[model samples]
Target: MGDKPIKQYRKSRPRAEELYSRALESLAGGVGHDLRRGHPLPLYISRAAGSRKWDEDGREYIDYGMGNAALLLGHAPPEVCRAMGDALELGFHFGNDHPMQLEWAELIQKLVPCAERMRFVNSGSEGSMLALRVARAFTGKTRVLRFEGHFSGWHDGVGKGAMIPFDKPVSAGIPPAVLDTIEVIPADLDSVAEVLEKDRDIAAVMLEPSGASWGTGPLTVAFNEGLRDLTRNHGVLLVYDEVITGFRYAPGGYQEYAGITPDLSFHGKIVAGGMPGGVLAGRADIMEVFDYTGDAHRDRYERVHHLGTFNANPVSTAAGIATLKRVATGLPHERANRLARQLRQGMDSILREEGVAGYAYGDVSIFHVYLEAFPGSGASDRERLVTRDVNVLKGIPAPVVSAFQKMLLARGIDLVSYTGGVTSSAHTDEDIALTLDAFGDVIRALVRERVIATLK
Candidate 1:
């Protein structure tokens, strides 16, 4: 045998790899959700505390993904766990009228100004679906307008064009006929005006106030105010899908951040404290549709059916209540913004030093890193063209991006598979420093390996 020795990974991720292989035998795509399937095998997490997680192979990582931006208070928070544990001792699931569920609803009403009344559901998808139903019933219209990049949910109705090619069905199972009921519009005010003028059957305009799916790009405050005016003028409902941005943005949610109140709002993610829960909240008059008061005419009230077996399970409600209560006073936005600025600034500096044609940007906690062909373009036309060209570059076949992610993984840093990462309150200044150091090293390695011509 030769005297040379085989190099081994400093941290073993073999158990996670093995688990994914085994999972593929039974589960489609080896995950409960399609988003969980990232390249080079998804890491199986054994346990997580604060901003760190241990993979099945016992490798520790600083988690910036943060449960797809759900872990606002970080993983396995003590308050959330304690509350849930107490609730579990009492009972997990009950009928729709559980006390903890009501408590959470009340808490949401207090935090979000527009939520005069609220209803609980099992997921953001369910909350959005139900909110749309309420909107249609209240507006007496059949169609709903949705934004190009925002994710409403996976249901057949609203899941038509979430994050895929514009105007194309994101998945195969949904029928083409359903697309007609959903009016697709870009974030631009001109597009909204054209759609609203053309489509009279539009019941509501539902969009993310902060646009989470498209790399956390925020809508201009002027655009949001214009939308509020337009929806009011047209007598249509404005539904803000605050599922991803709810508690992460601020205690009052993105509505407060944008200074525009919608007719209805759907919340999940942070509201559930990383548990399975969702809420639809809005004006009392509009929410009255879901009220089952026998005083109303049977036909009018019963026309809209809102029912779910596990709508407000006690365990999830308890976790949510604890999370919300903690965040109501804590300063997640400040901490997240600080970290985001540090990370973005560090990444941009590295890109500049390496002569890489790319940019990193985000708001508060969420951030995106995009590699492109053009380094700088100021004009709107040039910017738009650059964006389109950069998208095409991403679509083209390349191994450098995958290698970059694996390299980060090996160095104990985690990010969203696609193009972004989320920072949490649990991440210390040290964690931020460590992540920036790793990113710099990775860029240098990529350049050395000829992954790209130069960072500059």
Candidate 2:
């Protein structure tokens, strides 16, 4: 629960520590992604398959991160791997349109509710950036409205309002002018109406349809439905950033799950079957901004001019096709979601029995651990906790969360962001039971070390 678990973790992964020391000379921050900048040292994974990953030191963990929620079919599923292999034998990059790209788009269009027309991009950030550009071009508006704590991506335009201390700079290099174009507000229909009422130049209203932080700040379906109505009345475009929830929520994502079709929606993660690809899709007229016409004047000035070297590359398209074909049947969703429900219920039971002041909650295959609640709010405050209050959901003490992470990691379980994780069809009943046992141990240890407060 404290330094003891960290010590054990460090002791068990000497090879990873050595690799980290070597990595520090080349990799900035001694890691590739900011999230991998681990507590004591980042884990160096050697291989992964199914629901487990083996570290460089040959330590196996029941992986709940699932390649950052991209591995809906689990790591290197045979079908996806075989597809990628066959694609590799054919060609890698064609530098021109390929038949696989058409198949990929057809599959996505078949599934996603809002994807009438689409463009391929390299990442979720690129998808969002392109969606905003299309919205502005189609609507002839300048600014965008975003809900607080909803993560779009790490691009300059959407980065500012994602983190807390909302007024402060998210990154140093972002221009003040870029920040000015984004209007941040709470996830309330009234606040949204107020903004639309005041700002006539607003281009679009964008958010994570499952709420902020991939359901960490959970949003109700009613709110999303209301927002859709409000945006329609105000003549503003509605965009859903479905990077995490793309196929994980369902074949079509939260849009299909909630039955709320966005004007534009951007997706990554499972869309490409864990490959590095994303889709920017919505209404055909809006997407026509990217289409080329015969007239030189119109083509030169009016077209969006979107370009990417690896957009819908053959290998990624193959993987996406394989994954989506399976996801279409709804079996994977059933398995993953059932396991997630068990894990959530088990964690909540552990918290209650241990007298801890927290709960486990999320939608579909996603789960979050709020290990510490606000002062004076006991474990019974489930109603208040699920109110989608960003401050309260993300307000846990850093030290407490860190301890919780270390304790769980020491027990050979890996969570996404130290708060929660996404489930995959690869996970079994045994995996869930073992995860609960590890979680129970971690919770008890946290209480023993006074890292998390206990309800009286």
Candidate 3:
């Protein structure tokens, strides 16, 4: 153990605790999403600005969660909020087509490499579901090949391998037959080939281009391009579920960064300017499967139907239009990525200096912090991490993560979970320094408390 005494870090946020207690009476676990459920209590955010937010007890925090990576410009960006407000005055849903949607779609087509055709959906979840349906209809295939631990959405089919143990459904409602239609495997070319060869009826191969769990499990650019080529040669449609990477990785997103175009892609999160909406964009010919006036050979079951009551609605489209216009120059992504690089570098320096067991790793603008140190393993430790069946592999113990998160909150920093965090254009260099400083303290505390170790 270290010479220092363990610091009992705790924030005075009793109001948050009370609210969570009250919420538990009405809401399940006092939270909406499963991820928000906490060990002690959930944080009740009062207000948020560019890079900071206040909890119920008026505790200000430097927020790294950034709306779960949906806020590239940061929370309540005035420009986006003004646009949304104006659109709200106009109305949300219209029985007929609106002009603002044209601006939104046109901006997307102008930037995204695979936006030859596009359709609006209510959320990233809807976007993923529609992408699969279109692929099935266009290819007449009955199954999908997905990478293990890649999250498409919370839907029954593509949601299987994301966070739950491998091959286990995310929820209880999905049937066995629904899961049997999709195949999950480790992220490798041989596995891809084996799955394709074994299952001729596979409709599409889908993945998060940035890698599973937002690059906690990183993927190589060569492998991404190889998948495109492999799928095309095998007549299997390739789909990039870029719900997290869209508008964050680059101006044109991951497809532009990798220069490997897929047949389809799903976009959400930052695309709607911190609002609720998503997109299904890709090859026009294949997307025509959603059209009614298709070829004569197209049968009823072969035609894909997609409809959203709020699809292309004014508020989201207006916010999207404003956000795309502001971000089209690519300055936001560049700034966020620059900040991310700085944060990662600083974090790595601390880990090394402190002789911590784990490392910091990620792609352009995304990063994750792994606490479980595997001694005698170098970067290969990260490579080895991906091969494990995630259902059975618990990376860092949840309790340790939760304690770290609470400590971060006490220190006026908030992240999505124990590991990685999303950077934003609004985050200043000072914010990066503060986060790094807090991380160093937290790591040292964990060491003193016997939660983390200093490798000899």
Candidate 4:
């Protein structure tokens, strides 16, 4: 393998490197999304079709990030694209109401378990933000309880306890005062009970239903069962932020898949067919804040005034309708999860056979690769693989993950921030095999570099 020699990553990407240098002056970190940052240079994708994409340098890659989990059907899927194109020919924005919005919501309500009456928003962050506002207004409570490592979105209210230390906000812009409105706690059921009992004013319990950040730290069905009962008994609105899981896990998402319904839910990702849209859906009674027909200012706060420039725009909704129509059959879930299982199984087996002290695991289609052992983690390989420790993964040096990413690139696979990625219904058996073969190469490279120690 060493004699064969790995492809040197960037031998032909002068244009991309030049563009990154220019982009640095404009785009902070030379990338739009923070996770898009990379060493050497970010792979500037020119175009993508099906499961493969070509970067600016003309290097083809098997994309596992799948547009940050928004592309459940894969890049430039024909149906979604055609719907979006037809929408474009008609109009991109109406600014007023349109028929497509109702069609989109109806499809969502048909699929999502908790979706009764829903309002569209531009992004998942906005959906989660609105969900919390509705929960607070309905319950007449001041604070929200969210589990550590659970990412509801990039909004200020659900900011802490995700992609950052539980005690602090995800970024500095969030006012310290805002933290008072939110309480971040462990995901343990007893801890949840204690917090709910101690803080009677908690309006809702919000979390990513499939677990933190697409199951980097997976949750069991039993935990959700207890959580459902606890939240119900405590009178706290339960909100499932299914940004990455809503249409991907099953036609009805995690709530249906897990059989634990929530009071409210926010959906994005595949719900919008990778287009910029999201929705806040829930039981009709609690979602009444968005409906100001009877009166306004019924409580401490004014009626939930929710408006977005792109809310339920025709293009996004049309694409969403097409995407959800396909997801309704549950075949996408079957295909993507099967591919992921193959990828995860192969990668896990490689860690053992190649003697690397790491593991790969995820819920359904989403998967993660941990190059280091979980800290304070004496749990079995299986348990630790799904362990809920975010801070340590956050603390790993950038270069180690960068090396892993770069090496994987040399073998033609792309993962987001080297954390992990997801499979799409479009990802083929050949794609899975290619991914596993690439993983084999990268693991050897990491072992050679001592980025990952050999399994004892």
Query: Would you estimate the TM-scores of all the predictions?
Result: 0.90, 0.97, 0.92, 0.93
Kindly list the per-residue Cα lDDT of model 1 for residues 101-187, writing each as its tens digit: 778888888889789988888889998889888888888899988876667888877865465465787777887777778876667
Using lDDT as the measure, what is the rank order of every candidate, best first?
Answer: 2, 4, 3, 1
lDDT of each: 0.77, 0.88, 0.81, 0.82
Model 2: lDDT of residue 347: 98
Q: Over 4 Å off in model 4, which ranges? A: 1-11, 294-302, 373-397
Candidates 1 and 4, the one with greater lDDT:
4
Clashing pairs in 1: 354-455, 354-456, 355-455, 355-456, 356-455, 356-456
Residue 49's lDDT in candidate 2: 93
Q: Candidate 2: where are CA atoms >4 Å away?
A: 1-9, 373-386
Candidate 1, residue 154: Cα displacement in angstroms equals 1.4
Q: In candidate 3, which residue pairs clash?
A: 165-391, 166-391, 368-420
| Residue lDDT tens for model 3, 1-456 | 122312221235568667877897998657998878765567788899999998878878999899888888988889999999998888777856799888899999998999999999988989989988888888888898888778888998675777646677878888899988878888889888887887889999989887887776777899898898889889999999888888888878898888888899989988888789899999999887778765656646667866678888788889899888877898998899999899988888887787776667777778777776323234423334333333323356776677678677778888865577888889999999999899889888877776764555
Candidate of highest TM-score: 2
- Name the candidate, 2 or 3, with the larger TM-score value: 2
Residue clash pairs of candidate 4: 355-455
Alpha carbon lDDT at 139, candidate 2:
94
Q: For model 4, give the RMSD to the true fold.
A: 3.3
Q: Taking the tens digit of each residue's C-alpha lDDT, what string does model 2 give over 1-456?
A: 358966886787799878888999998778889989887888889899999999988878999999988999888899999999999999999989999999999999999999999999988999999989999989999999998888899888886667886655578898999999999888889999999999999999999988888988889899998999999999999999999989889888988899999999999989999999999999998888987789899899877888899999999999989999999999999999999999999999998888777788998999998866334356454434445688777777788777787778878999888598999999999999999999999888878777776764
